[model samples]
Target: MKRRTVLRGLAGSAGSIMTIPALAQDRYPERPIRLVVAFSAGGPTDLMARRLAERLGAHLGQSVVVENKTGAAGTIGATEVARARPDGYTLIVAVSSSHAIAATLMRRPTFDPVKDYAGVAVLGTVPMALAVHPSFPARTLQDFLRVAQDAPEGLSYGTSGAGGIAHLSGELFQREARGIKLTPVHYRGASTALQDLLANNIPIVMDTMASIAEPYRGGQVRILATFAEQRSPYLPDLPTAREQGLPGVVSNTYNAVLAPAGTPASVLATLNGAVRTALADPTMQAFMASNLVDPFPDPTPERTMVFIRSELEKWRPVVQATGLSME
Candidate 1:
């Protein structure tokens, strides 16, 4: 009889403890929620976060505010989110490098990417196009490679940041083209690099289509190829890097949301629902396409994890070759 009583007490305690978080989740978002972006406002990530916030508010019946915590190549913001109270009140919008590349790049990474956070769902990838200045003489990808092979010196290209996707793309292009030598010029952001490209200060730049689409259309820059798996419908006339013979050059900039580790699973489900609702709207799709973002196929937990892991593995070699740094 004593043992039976003891067992019952323990089971009751266990049940209550499990029920607490579930109950709290049911009442979650009784207040405003904070969505942290690891970069400055107006960047691709921030723009997407704001759009999601607007639609998520309608779905959740709560305000989702976006806060930019820029600096240290997104480290400051990521670290903040990792340490936040896991009450579902605070979350983060992360990118490819922030979670994957930063994990290995930073000498003393602030938090473990997989261990310290729970992925919400991927937002999508921002497609990029490789371009050069109009004055560069080579009008074709083949012609450019031929010239690059012949010179292999003083040729240079610009990327958003050192050890970033843009930089890695440039490096991968160099490695694949074999004999095409180019110096990499790193900028704090792609905007800065684009400015130099416009002035003819830099010969080449690998950046997002959204960032350079207008300029390219206006003849301010010459697009070499789109770095996507397939030709973008929006830019249907352009060929993918792979189709142009650079098989290793197709890449995209990814964006996703993640909650601080230990957030209640029930809360996560509710938040996921809001994300799905927002991402499914046709209006959102049009907006993303206009901005050169390819809306992800599905925003589910399983898909998000698979995407992250695949991206990590895909870029492992590039990251190793470039030796990118967070500092």
Candidate 2:
């Protein structure tokens, strides 16, 4: 055969071989799917992941087991999933901390959130609250701002960690609340922060509603404002920061499902469709609302990527302002 004909035959064979895996994905996820959560088993992230696992497993006809590989503010488990095979068997249940805030906040990152993962579904978001010691003398968000602005020194607030979403959200809030600035006093966890706030060791604490819901209800701490766009169901009488004065200071941590970057488009479609269906279930919707987890209107993969990118951009200024860097 001529040289051109031989080259054509070799190219065709290569193309055929390359298409095998993509074609095989038509019957994808034959075995159990591993959903990795980068936090402990009881936290909001883990809870969300487990709920999603049940929904996804029901739809996909496979047990979606949740495995916790906790550490690094959600980068450890994320790294494991980023290195996983792209056969749709391994996925990461990533939060805004890992995918957005940490992507820009951490100086030493384990993986690239945008490059190493493909969006499967945008799970949901939980708005944060700015809580204060009950005796701090602020009845509302505007009152708190006035007190903070008039303070002799920088008012300090507590957060779960330095580079986590809580800290970044606090920083963002400080930036938006002109003439009023609050410094973060980082702790090992939200419980510790709450303890400090209760003891009046710290005047303020910023954390997700899941962490502070009980405290706020029990009157242990006064929620000055929520970062939600509207009223929280749990605190219907309470107004959001936007409702008070600062309109651009809303912040929340969200969960998004992602697969290894090279996963087949067909496999991704299967996973996304299953996730959308699961989240749409009335039971899931009720659960999410009660838990303060708001579902995305459009959770498609394309929209998910755009949302992730926007989150990264949104937190970049906060990171720059706070000068936070995690090990």
lDDT of each: 0.84, 0.86
Clashes of 2: 0
TM-score of each: 0.89, 0.88
Residue pairs clashing in model 1 are: none
lDDT of 1: 0.84
lDDT of 2 by residue, 144-173 (tens): 988998997879999998877888888889
Distance from true location, Cα of 122 in model 2, Å: 1.3
The sequence of per-residue lDDT tens digits that candidate 1 reaches over residues 1-327 is 999999999999999999986777788878999999999888778889999999999888999999999987788899999999998899999887787777768887788777788878888887667799999978888888887888836478899988888887777778877777878899988999999999999999988888999998899999988888887778788787889888877678888888988887778888888898898899888888888787787777667777777777777787878765656
| TM-score between model 1 and native | 0.89
